[model samples]
Target: MALAKPSGLYPCTRSLPQAKTRSFPSLLQPKLHPSPNPSLKPFDATPGLSLVSSSAPVLHLRPRRGFRAPPRASSDPSPLEESPQKDATSEYGLLRRATLVGTATVASKILGLLREIVLAAVIGVGPVATAFNHAAVLPRFSSSFLGGVNGPIHITVATTLSKLSKESRRQLTRKMLNIMFLIGGAFSALTYIYADEIISLTAPGLQVLAQGNLIREMAMNQLKLMTPCILVSGSMAVGFGCLTSEGENTYLALSPSITSIAVIASCAVYILMKGSSSSSLNSPLLGVFISSGASVGSLMQWIIQVMIHKNSERETKFISWMDFFNDKDVHKLFALMLPATLSSGLVQITSLTDLYFSSFIPGAAAGLSYAHLLTMAPLGIFSSTLILPLLPTFSRHTKPSSLASLKENLQKAIVLCMVIILPITCTSCVLAGPVISLLFQRFKFDSSASSFVSSLLLCYSIGSPLWIVRELCAVVFYSLGDGNCPLLINLIAIFMNGILDWLSLSVFGLGAQGLALSTSCVSALSVLALLLLLSNKLGGIINIRDMRGPFLLLLICCAISGFTAMFSYRMLQFFLSTISILRLFGLTELLSILLAGILGMSAFYLPLVFAKFAGVFLVDSLWTTLLNR
Candidate 1:
């Protein structure tokens, strides 16, 4: 709109004309496309918005003597004066941002891996591991449930931030950050105050380690030690989220790697200085202390984000805490936040359920942690990389332009996750002993720990893809500004998981593996719910029916490959020594897996390649007749 000049008749030459000699740098505006609104009927007479373009006046900062502007006095419009530059981060601009954000996210995931490996080797799934996991998860949970895309509150935030001016936008951002920080602080105190009680509730099985008052006291002390992270990291993440809204993503994307690097470096020094002994609390506690170093790492991240946000937007100013509370944006945020929290929070609670099921047996808690380390690795690497980065992409999209972009992105993301993770999953199933030995053989990770941890790792891997799919669906719902759907889906999963976990433990006697299995099942169900629910809302951008033949073929391939891997591993194992057998078994397993996979592909694709769905008709008929309800 080039915003019309405010009503005025100024003394031009008497003072100095605002436009005269004012620096005029070529402020290349955002390359915006006309996003046609597909949600509304074209025939409807919409007199208002059609005259106005969706794109705003994006002030692209050039390395020049600032912009030559018709500089008005302090009497200028307050909105433009106090707002962040309105630059839309779009899929069209993905390449431009590749170095800044894409590279940074890649770095973060790599660092996260180093962090997990160090934790497993040094901490070995003890109380310290459990404590650190809870502490670290606190901020992440707060971020997800509050401003994260998966939560219901995300819809409101996305819509509000998308619709509002830079000034109004900052108004809400500051308010939301302050309110969430206070809530995080309260949670922090609760975590610290009743740390022992919270731990017991969270991990009933792990409570066996304490005697008399020692247990309670130890849990409380650990909780207190970890509590501040909830406030510090959680509050910092709010700024990160706002920066995201402000179109500055690289700083946050690279922050995880920085945090992990700090933890890894500190832990390496701790391991060298303290040595790897678990006879007393001091050794393990050193790891805990080093783990706390991540908070410091997070601080570095916060500093970077704040600097980037400030540099990106010069008009931003501090928001008053009192004035923030009175704003309608604050009230609307919690309204959105509570339900969104319920949805995303349910997913977080699954970890607690995992803890509950994992603690029932000796070494179960630690074993689950090791398994979770593996599970979270790929998830954190890819899904976290994609979800947050793509959220702004979705926010800018108000049209039904092409689900192809998102579909392709999802397919590639899923395939990438599967490709990177399939080998790990196979190894967990077959080379559990060797893999655990290679990773956590040192310190307190004994033979039993290795076996149980490997089992849990395999079980948890089953849900990894499902988790990503659910995340994608949640993003769709959030982008559409409907948070209740994902929340409802999660609510169902929570109910299903609790039931499934109990049955898995009591009926199947699967122990930690059962907990992992239940999680996998619940996650799959959640993904299904999200797909079904969002398909209806987005008016069927996804074509599940189109992939029916290929999907069946993939399933057939998976089953065949599973059996081949198992049989090949066994045959190879029988013919060699334990050490030599693992190597041979791995080789034969890979060969058999490849062969079976090819057969499955041929079974489905050969027909499609030749334009014949009939090739899989027999299987489809059987599935429809026998499996159809």
Candidate 2:
């Protein structure tokens, strides 16, 4: 499961790797994993000036005799010549990406939460925290880099060209495709050339990997192998987004999942090679890196997409790529992507800066990253997953009335994110210690790391909701073909983040955890700025205030759940200490904490269950009602 499908409606869909293109046979090859559920449930906030439901009521009123509930209204645009019809009941395409993607993202976030707890408990907050985070930095940066590289041209070309002449459109697409590929390839080569120098800058000691003198030479090794992904992903974005807008999301959406699969495989392979020797395990330096993963995954993704694009060209005879460069279209593409890169690149640069500063500040090198991982566990769910799948459908609509409809969808997505994440973030902040204990206390992982990481996690959790909000705001603007505004906000926020990082980490002596807190603050500010900027441009294209009450309700519920979780944790601890026969009581107690916390959220949302409110507050239709009203 992944937080919102990062772009696809499911993990299978948002894999991002699907943008990869190879020859025909490989492209046509059957999938290796089970297909994902395209249908999902969504939670929502209320409509303005309307009564809302906490849950559907059991009523005497029933569907017409022999009649089923009317199929759900679709949120995606009515099909155009190039677009596909979304599910009538869907909140997105025919299948409703919001529901499927949101829920899976929620589930994935939950699992990621568990995964992080496990890592924290197992690794502790010291060397391992630094190591895992260090290992993660490149991959995280790469995704952001790719997002930046592709974000501009994607919306610019996709939104604009769909309005262009057919023959002119085809010709332009082929040229853009070729040029983008060549640029991405060049970027990959540059990364290969300077990976070590770059890594050394981020991690001073790891340059030894190039010398083959160290076991896991992290110094410069990590950057060398991983940076290539930014290039591959850049090339793939234009192709995938183009096809997806035309209603071909099956593979393109699922490609990112391949990265996860590859990472897992690489870890498993490394584990086997190393064995379980305590002596060898003592070294945090030896961790799984994904350069090879990128190399292989990129090929897989590229092969499939290349095949699809070429095959489609053969049948349709619609595209031409000769004279790709020096054309007006190339200029337009560059005009679109250039600002996007700088804007998107700002985030990665900040992250890289975080690494730089964190390394210098005592144990911070590891601590800040540890905390970030915990927070990201949820972000991957609520924010990344939803935004990725939503962008295309959203870009397809620019009409004032359509923005109104989509605002409701955004409202629904926001409420759903808060419902799950609010409770989790608050409870995790309160129970950071114990949860970290239960999850990561095995093998080479230790308690110190857990404690430190937990402190940082709590701080980061404060801004959990804002992360998703930022994504929604950016997507809304990007869909409107206004990348420049969001880009500006991202840069400004980066500067603010830098100042805060210095104050929190250096001035306050709050350490890595402080750095995380600073980042969260900046993130919230970015959300505010993005929203205001869009509102100015949109002439009220989007309205987030109507749902403020529901957001408040969700916040209140989260508070109650968190307080209850703390109480449950203490009581469970006491009971377990007293019962010898129930030696496994600790496990049972953890379950109670989780269950109670979940129920607490349910109890808070209970008001939305009634029929009147349900129409506006339910995830999909209810949300639609609320927004429409």
RMSD of each: 14.6, 12.8
Per-residue lDDT for 1-629 in model 2, tens only?
Answer: 00111121222311122222121211112122122443421211222221112332211111234544335458743323233244212433422444454455555455445544444433344443454456556555555345322254554555545555666666666666666766777866876687655555665533332322241244346555665565666557676656645545445445555555565455455557776566544454334333455445655666677788777771123234546445776676567667666776786767766676676554565566556767766666545445555555565556665554455455445555555566567777877777666666666666665577678778888987778777677667766756688778878878888888788766887777777777778888888888777667655433354445544555666666777777766776676657765565546656655665665555545544431232233344534633443
CA lDDT, candidate 1, residue 158: 49
Error (Å) of candidate 1 at residue 506 is 2.6
Give the Cα lDDT of each candidate: 0.55, 0.55
Find the 10 residues in a row with the least total lDDT in model 2: 1-10
Tens digit of per-residue lDDT, candidate 1, span 1-629: 11121111111112211221111111111222222333322121111110011121321222224424344578655533212232122212332343345456667766776666677777666655555554444544543344333234444464457556888777676666656667777887777676666765665654565431333344445556555556654455556656666666666566667667877888877767766666543344664566467556656665665676567563235567678767887676666556666777787777767666655565565577667766766565455445655666565453565343444344433433443344445434554555566667666556666777877877887777677667767766666556788888777777788888899889988777888888888888887777777656655544555445445644554454455555555655455334665475555444434443444334433433243222132223223433332
Model 1: what TM-score?
Answer: 0.69
**TM-score between candidate 2 and the true structure:** 0.73
lDDT of 2 at 279: 51
State the weakest 10-residue window (summed lDDT) of model 1: 20-29
Off by over 4 Å in 1: 1-102, 130-140, 143-159, 209-217, 278-284, 314-322, 398-434, 541-544, 556-629
